[model samples]
Target chain A: MTQLPVRTDRKLGLVIDLDTCVGCHACVISCKGWNTENYGAPLSDQDAYGADPSGTFLNRVHSFEIRPDEGAAQLVHFPKSCLHCEDAPCVTVCPTGASYKRREDGIVLVNEDHCIGCGLCAWACPYGARELDRAAGVMKKCTLCIDRIYNENLLEQDRVPACVRTCPAGARHFGDLGDPDSAVSQLVAERGGIDLMPEQGTRPVNKYLPPRPRDRIGADSPALTAVAETASGFLAWLDRTLDRLPGGGLARMDAPAKEENS
Target chain B: MNPAPSVIIFTTLSGAGFGLLVWLGLGLPGVTGLTAFGFFAIAYLLAVGGLLASTFHLGRPERAIRAFTQWRTSWLSREGWTSVIALILMAGYGAGLVFLGTRWTALGLAGAAMSVAVVFTTSMIYAQLRTVPRWNMALTPVMFLTLSLTGGALLAGQMAAAKALLLLSGIVQIAYWKLGDRALAGSGTTLATATGLGAPRAVRAFEPPHTGTNYLLEEFVHVVGRRHALKLRAIALTLAVVLPLVLLMLGAGHLVAALAALCHLAGVAVSRWLFFAQAEHVVGFYYGKR
Candidate 1:
């Protein structure tokens, strides 16, 4: 059925800590490597060694710069995938009944056999989570590493998702988010984790722990202020020369003029 | 948002085809035998041909039969079902008119209703997509329904209805354009909400996920030039509504009607192109394209 389950037994999802993620993309590489090898089809690359190389990826890392109202700008590495929402729009929008949310684990999966690749499910998703694999002619998405998560053959410690296991910075954490006492849920509570696009009403199982307050390190730094106060001789001359250039030190120039007039 | 030619053709032709069926089922021309057959043939050709064109963009077109199974939850599935049922009903109604020279009022009325339902479902397929705020509105369905009816009246040679509808469609088109321009901003979804980042306007996209274009960017982020869009809208409005009305008023002769239909079709085609080209998908926010 394309309709989502009324409820899931356990909301198994990932907790990504933005504070700790170093924007390394190690998880992305590992996810691609493991999924292509073990899952349904290989993530094919078009023009792999040439100009304009593009390919299907289950995970991607995007960097964004956010400036606070009164502080220096900060760079945040956003790793996005299927949120496996309580109300997964992608699942319900599938015409072939190929996209479904697992009632047991709350993970959304695509049945390659049933998918007609109309891409309607992809359109319904607010997050760019699903991609139509040109080679397989099927919709591919984050499976939450279903193959390895419960595999008896793999070692117990290796049962987690490849991305989670391969993350060097330990940025990605996976556990039963449905369980209030789970470590992932506890982490979310402690760090004030937030849902991406909560107004979209996806009710995503995955949570993002926001970055901690950053130190004062830019133009308003105490060290820079001290250095500016002690400017003298050749150093002061160089500052004045640079300040006089067009569009240079305009704020400072305006400040002195305003003071003189007042 | 790529404005795939197949999709443009599909929506335009199919909407017009279904609209024509609506009038035929209402027995406006009241033709029988060969004349009915001729009209039915054109309707079927446009509607069926357009439905086929829609499948061209699918990755697995061979598996399209599976699309009919999920009508309960999927609007696309509902559209498929409604279109098929409408075609079947219209087929029976047309057969009765052509072979038996009979007009079954109940069957014809049912077919007409279904035909209108098919167009409505089709519009809902786009309208239901909240990700594309421009299409997710009451006006989308209104525009689609009005255009379909207006095009139907023109083809059926109903001068009064066609004239009234053409004027209405023009107003609706202008209103849709004016309102759709503000839809994304009105939806209150910005980069900050999308990423849960800084103040809504303060966050900026520093880098994309990849250097080369991926499926998301290729499929969603289409940039149409402002001047070109304005020129096309002018052309569409002139040919689709204005020219057709003028030709009909001058004389609804066979030659003039045919010319009018051709012009209207070309205009609708341009309008359909703008429909896809102008739509801004919310996923574009991640790449700062929005």
Candidate 2:
């Protein structure tokens, strides 16, 4: 059914901490390596070695510079995937009933066999999480590493998503988010983890732990003893001291300003 | 958002086809037996041809039948179902008009209602989506319905009706574009919202997720220049509205009506292209295209 389950005992999801993510892309590479073969259809690359190679990837890591009004800019690496929202639009919008949200684990998935690859699911998604596998003629998306996560044969420690297991920075945490006492749920509450685009109203199961702002670093360091003691601004005292140099120290390096003024 | 030619043709073609069917259901002036056949042939050809064109863009076109199964919650499914109902009703009505020399009022009315409903469902496919804020509006369905009526009136050679609808639909199209522009400009979803980084005054992409243009970028990150759009809109308005209105005023002339229909079709095609090209999906924010 395209309609979401009324309720689920567990909402297994990921909590990504931006503060700890180094943007190394280990998780992305790991997810690609795992899902390409593990999922129902192999994720294919078109012109993989050619001049313009492109392929399907379930996960993507985007880097951005966020400029704040009152502080230095911060670079953040945002890893994105199908959030498996409680109200998964992609699932409900599918005409073929191919896209579905699981009642048991709360993972949203596409039945490749039934998928017509009409691309409606891709359009419905706000996250840009799902991609059409051109070769397989099906939509591909992060399955939350369903095969590995639920495989009885796998070791207990390996029973997690490839991205979570392979994250070097340990920035990714995965567990049942529905249980208030669960580690992931507790972490979300403690860190004030926020849902991306809460206004979108998808009610995503996944949460993102915001990076701690180092707003005062370097810019507001305690003044040096000499610099603090200066009557005028510290730069004025430094200017006078530097004027004693061989070629009027600061002037030589900043001669272009004088030339422009003249 | 790619303005895939197949879909544009599909929507415009089928819309006109269904529009013609609406007029046929209400009854046309040429009530002769073979004339009905001829008119229906054109309507079916365009409607079915457009429906087929839609399938051309699908990756697995063979599995399109599966689409009919999910009408419960999917607008696309409702579209397919309504289209089928409209097509069957119209087809039966055409057959009756051909052999029996009679119009079944109930069947014709139901078919006409379904025809309009099909177009409504089609518009809802995009209008209901929150992903593209510009497309998600009540005006979308109104625009589709208005365009369908205008096209139908033109095809049926109802020059007076066509002229009035042309003017109304033209105004609706302009209003829709104006509202769409404002909606996109003022949309709350930003790069900050996409990445869950709310602190920033402005967030810009330092690096894309990949060097290669992925499916998301290819499918959603369409950019249309404002100057070109304005020019196209002007052309669309002249051809689709102004010229059609002028030509249709040459009342009771089939040649002028046919010419007006052709011009209006060309104009609607342009507007459809702009519709897709201008849509800025929320996913575009991820690629810094929004």
Best by DockQ: 1
lDDT of 1 by residue, B1-290 (tens): 78999999999998888998999999977888999998889888888999999999998999999999999999899989999999999999999999999999889899999999989998998998888999999999999988888888777777788889989999999999999999999887789888888687788999998989999988888885434888889998998899998898888688998888878888888998899988888999999996
Model 2 lDDT tens row, B1-290: 88999999999999999999999988864464898998899899989999999999888999999999999999999999999999999899888998899889889989999999999999999998898988999999999999998998999887778878998998999999999998865667777777777643577888899999889887888775434999999998888899989886666677888899989989999999989988888888777776
Cα deviation at A249, candidate 1, in Å, is: 44
Task: Please report how far candidate 1 places residue B235 from its true position, in Å.
Answer: 1.7
Model 1 chain B poorest 10 in a row by lDDT: B218-227
Stretches > 4 Å off in candidate 2? A215-262, B224-227
Write candidate 2's Cα lDDT for A1-262 as tens digits: 7988998778999999988999999998999999988888998999999999999999889888878886788898989888989988999999999999998989999999999989999999899889999999899999999998999999999999999999999999999999999999999999999888777889999999998877475757875443454446787878777778777765756457757966
Candidate 1 Cα errors over 4 Å, as ranges: A217-262, B225-227
Each prediction's total of clashing residue pairs, residues at least 3 apart in sequence or on different chains, is 0, 0
Every model's TM-score = 0.91, 0.91
**In model 1, what is chain B's TM-score?**
0.98
- Rounded to one decimal, what is candidate 1's iRMSD? 0.9
